[model samples]
Target: MMGESNRTTEIPCEFYSDKYPDPSNHPITIVLFTLLYTFVFLISFAGNMGVIYATIRHRSLQTVQNIFIVNLAISGVILACLSIPLTPVTHIAKQWFFGSLLCRVVGGTQAIGTFIGTFSLCAIAVDRYFRLVIAPGRPLRKVNAMRITMIMWAVSIVVTLPYVYHMNLMKYSPKHGLCGWFCTEKWPSPFSKRAYTIFVLVIQFLIPFSIMTVCYHAIFSFLRKRAKTRLTSIAQQANLLYVLAATAGRETQQHKEQMTHLLDQKKRVVAQKRRVTLILVSMVFIFGITSLPHNFVSTLMEFTDSRDLLTFYKTDYTYIVSLLTHLVGNEPDTTVAPFASLQPLHSFVNRYHSAVIPCANFETVFIWYINEYSGQFSSLAMLSCVTNPLLYAFLNPEFRELVLNGLAGVSWANNFVSKSWHPTQTTVL
Candidate 1:
């Protein structure tokens, strides 16, 4: 199968060209994409369900921060549910089953999804910065948060309104020879493509991204300061407690065994994934970095009288395809060149010469190690997935207990199902 797949080594011919084309028209391709999407949806559903279950069951899990997390997960799941299926079809046949009205609706939903996903992330960053890093005891106004979120959604929805007017399901260019639904100059009275071009780039992405960047910078600043404060407090307090306990009575013996952590051991193993949250933020990053060109191609179609956008569109198509490849695990060797301006047979490669590619090689090694170890380290590493859920528990002890209890009940129910299903049905005579 691998060898058969490897035979198709040609990249997409061009962005606007028929590479894979829409798959919905193909019985087999539609079925495959549908099944793949359904599977991804189910896994994400189960993962997020477990989270919600735990949070609801454990009363202590109802922290404000967890509320935002729940919102984030909900939005992401909605995105996954809506998007994964549509993507392949749009790519394959370029036929949109739903007409212009539906096209506009899709445009609206896409905007909403984009808005929610990004804003939710920014919200989490702010909440974490205040709650964890600064340890600010005061709560921000929930009303304000709702207002901000509502505004973002409203803006996104409004931005998509033009797509309704602009999107006309049409056959592809007679010149291009592909017949599929295309968003074109059908409804030009109310909507201008240039206006849309500017709006999508400016409102949908640029603004939200700028805010996210600022939020992260502020978070890092708070983190650095808080780390120092926490380390000092932990050190001084531990020492004072130790000095006092040394001269104390029999109760000190019980305390000695459990809390005798070394002074230099600043990290707690249980909370290690919090440190990796920084890396997870990069996942959101890959989405944007990869998606930027596609957004540009779409923009050109919407605005500007430039047929040149088509030229760049084809150039950018390969880039967008490359970016999407990463998401689906179809990686290309992105690095075909050497690192550094060192001589062709530089000392690093020649002297003690192991011909190691630099970042790309290490990244490949890292990916392999992660894949190999992920299952074995599931309890340790996958804990990051639960970090928000745990934070909910920590922040609100009542919610924590409630969520934990609910999750326990759900687990028990699942176990019962497994047991009940174990017995196979005999064929009737």
Candidate 2:
């Protein structure tokens, strides 16, 4: 729906006509993208649900870091659910099929989706650094996580206000056409599209990205120092223990066994920590990859004149808008890619049950699940669906464990398929 003042026939409608064009759009491109879209949607759906499954089933995962992650996953799922089912149409018609209400829904969703996807990572970075540097002993409590999540949602809604309220559907020449679904601003002003675009890219993207870099750098440094110190302490203790045991004259096999058990346990903890760290680093790289293009194009778009901006928006070159439109908004796929890659974590989650998940808090999880399952949006929705749970399930270890346990409790089908089979004997050995 076109919002605000509708000047009839003022703008050329050559590109779009009074009558619907016969299906001349390339089927091959649509078919290929449809496949890509379906593939991405399915991944995102499973990923976000997995995140929800993990978080709710395990109390240990209910920390502020993970709650925030669930929030991101919820947003991604919402975006995906709203967007994916409509993919074929978007591929075929190059137009919005749903009514004005859905158009605004799509528009508002795209805005919220991107904000949460990018903003959640921003929040995670801040929270992570806060924990690492400020208070390693104290986790961000659940109450505080709720507070932060509420604020984030509030702000996201506020940011999306322009689209949610300002949008209107236009009935052009006896033909009803839904225009401007993907973060498209209908009414033009002094800044027109530029102001909103700048707000989205600079404030939402550039600002957060800057913060993330600093936080990660600090976290990385802290982890390095901590690891070295731990190694040193272990080495010193080993030497001392060896010397003391020798002095005792007779070494008990039980003592040796106990010491071996302790070392093995310590090794597991270190490995677990390393796995989480790997997730964080992977997120950093992907975040940069997915977001940098949009930000770069945004920066260029902001500086250049209308013609250039329109060209950039319309051309779909590099499929930048489509990438943002479909990829980042969906946070599940973002995390799921990593989850799928990390077989150990995925295998564990596969066994977990959804029923054991805290029913009280599953609205958000349901929100995520529905979004991914209903995938009906253009590529924009896909982008918003993919990013969140990646950070949750991978970057944060406890959340990963929670997701594992939750899956074990519910989703009987998934539980069996993921966990029924034994790992390869080689790995067990």
Candidate 3:
């Protein structure tokens, strides 16, 4: 299961071979995190499902923007259905209970889903900006939109193939006489690990965020100028109408109806502007908050050497291995740590540090980081999953109506919820 190579690394084995250790040793921590994970998984699954259903059931929601929303929903659904459930299971089991094949498939699927989700957000922002600013009055064709989505999935799968390759089912024997399968990466070239991680961080997170920032800013500026110009024109028309009414000695019914219509149109335009502003603001804010911390930690771990963090942890894994061997009544090797049991994990870490520019074994560091900040990841997953649907319901009256209609269409639920609630549709300009 340890890939096709025999070169062992002891540090990774030490972390993986032991039986489920209660690292936190707090019952409350376990209970709280378990509840959090369960809540996130359930809500994410339901919310994303609702988004997909609404998009498919309602023709009004089949616009280019909503198409991207559907794509985002699909990615969120994959993660919520397949990946989020594993968080609590891994926390409780403390070992890779699933075999090697599942190990690669699950890891690769999560990577694919996450990357797709981020890219979908970027695509949506770009499409919106393109329609409003670059090519006003011309909507993107449905065929072109479908092609873009297909290309996105294709690129994502290609990017994720490496994760499937590097991931393996780890097995090892330790001084305590423990042995078991643990899921981890066994890099063919340790240097590739550093390059792969940094590549993912930049391509998936940093570049997307930058794109969103620029697109959103340009959208905001254009809307502001346009709104101001329209307002000025309306005010001038009002002054002219007043002067004409004074000259004629009375305001005609036709003039009054015209004024009322203009006022209503102005109000609708203002509301539409506010809704668009909220949509982009919430998207940018939620994505930045949920994703930045995890990527920052991952990037920091990638660039910094193990030696830097080793001093902070105050425990040389090599020294700890020697200590463990002496406790088990074995003569310690002067050149290597005496625990042949620890070979696989140590070899993997050492090869990376020596072969590449000095960098930490991210797998071990990330696991420790995950244990320390378990709640953060859970919160991120839950918040990200729920954001798109919640924003649609909050900002788009049409989508909200569609969701209500779909719910009311359910036979058992129809009695309580009315299916006739409809509002005037606001067309995006």
Most TM-score-accurate candidate: 3
The parts of candidate 3 lying over 4 Å away from their true place are 1-25, 176-179, 241-269, 305-381, 392-394, 410-429
Q: Number of the top candidate by lDDT?
A: 3
Name the candidate, 2 or 3, with the larger lDDT value: 3
Distance (Å) between predicted and true CA of 374, model 3? Answer: 10
lDDT of 3 by residue, 159-277 (tens): 88875665566544453334454555556564677677667767876899999999988988888788878878888887788899999999999789878877976886687677667
Model 2 Cα RMSD, Å?
13.9
| Per-candidate alpha-carbon RMSD to the true structure | 17.2, 13.9, 10.4
TM-score of 1: 0.56
Residue-pair clashes, model 3: 15
Q: Tell me which of candidates 1 and 2 scores higher on TM-score.
A: 2
- Model 1 misplacement above 4 A: 1-35, 48-63, 130-135, 172-192, 233-259, 262-265, 269-429
What's the lDDT for all of these models?
0.41, 0.49, 0.57
| Residue-level lDDT tens digits of model 1 in 245-314 | 7768444755565346634335542132254344335534543553453344334323322322212433
